[model samples]
Target: MILFENVSKTYPGSHEALSNVSFHLHRGDMAFLTGHSGAGKSTLLKLIALIERTTRGQILIGGQNLAGVTKRKIPYFRRNIGIIFQDHRLLLDRTVFDNVALPLIIAGLDYREITRKVRAALDKVNLLNKEKQLPATLSTGEQQRVGIARAVVNKPPVLLADEPTGNLDPELSEEIMKMFEQFNQVGVTVLIASHDLELIKRMQHRTLVLGKGKLIAQFPEEDS
Candidate 1:
């Protein structure tokens, strides 16, 4: 669950990236964040992930105030959230299995458990056979799936994606969205920031829109 109370984020030059944006995403809810470029979508996700701190107001995740989270506890806190990027962000040199296994490794799982989770994640993305391959050897869409696999390999409770389907074709984009749906059905809270209005409409989930630095609209499924 996520709750933002009058949250605002301003940069060093006093450029406010978010202005009094507030919203509540209940546990297991799936929503899309949409707006024009520079509309603070990424900033909002970063605030939740603690990549950046809020300039004002407060953020609560599963009842834990992020303001109280110390820098030393960031890594431990992140274990509850999974993030996926549009660029795939895979390691060029490592095998796919290794990349997906990184999070579990950091969490100190043993080799057998890591192997099992890595294989299961790859299977979820239909990339189990490609586990031994390097990132460069995969196609664009395949690479993105790899990123998704890596993000969910740890089975985090909340998932955040920034323009996840930006680089893929329409069919691939739909496939990626369905993957997120599958995760959500299993009770993973999903928040995706994307610009594809048509795709968002097709998904028919809750949508939150932003303009400039403010939350302009939030539509429930029936209203969307």
Candidate 2:
């Protein structure tokens, strides 16, 4: 449900992050974005998330042009897209349940609904029992799972993860990828920007590869 047509992003100093990158990710598609460090993977995701504006070209999400989205509407626009970061950005002092519940709370949901959704999200990441625990008390992998739980707690239609498995061991990385796969199976559009080529190969999903500031290749190729 994401389409980028001849999109390019250039920073203030004339550094181009993306150069005419064009791709269409249909609804429910699961894909990976891969490239070397400074290859513009993060910039591409930022453009889609509207965290940064494109220097040229256009981006359409679910048929809505992001260029038309006003600054006042960004919060509402983001409600449909869930983002997970490599570093588990959980509140150090809050319990896992509270962290996962934060988004729902901000959305003004009722307490009972928030409780139910938080529990369900925690269960998905196998962290239901740790709901009362602080982030510092959890293992590295558990902390990452907590991040995932918080991202999906709102059940957004599109999920974007940046280097989600970067800090975890191979086993944990695989586990995290599996969780993304599970979400995709249930129809959540999944696009992950990661540098782990080995892991991306193992997943065998469509991948967009970048180099410098251009889309260099697309694995398995798309049909005409």
For all candidates in order, the CA lDDT equals 0.95, 0.94
Give the alpha carbon lDDT tens digit for every residue of 1-224 in model 2: 99999999999987898999999999999999999989999999999899999999999999999999999999999988899999979999999999999989989999999999999999999999999999999999999999999989999999999999999999999999999999999999999999999999999999999999899999979774
Indicate which candidate wins on TM-score.
2
Question: Can you write out model 1's per-residue Cα lDDT over 90-175, one digit (the tens) per residue?
Answer: 99999999999999999999999999999999999999999999999999999999999999999999999999999999999999
Q: Positional deviation of 56 in candidate 1, in angstroms?
A: 0.6
In order of appearance, the predictions have TM-scores of 0.98, 0.98
**Highest lDDT against the true fold, candidate:** 1
Candidate 2 TM-score over all chains jointly = 0.98
Q: How much does candidate 1 score in TM-score?
A: 0.98
Model 2 CA deviation exceeding 4 Å by range: none
Clashing pairs in 2: none
Q: Which ten residues in a row have the lowest lDDT in candidate 2?
A: 215-224
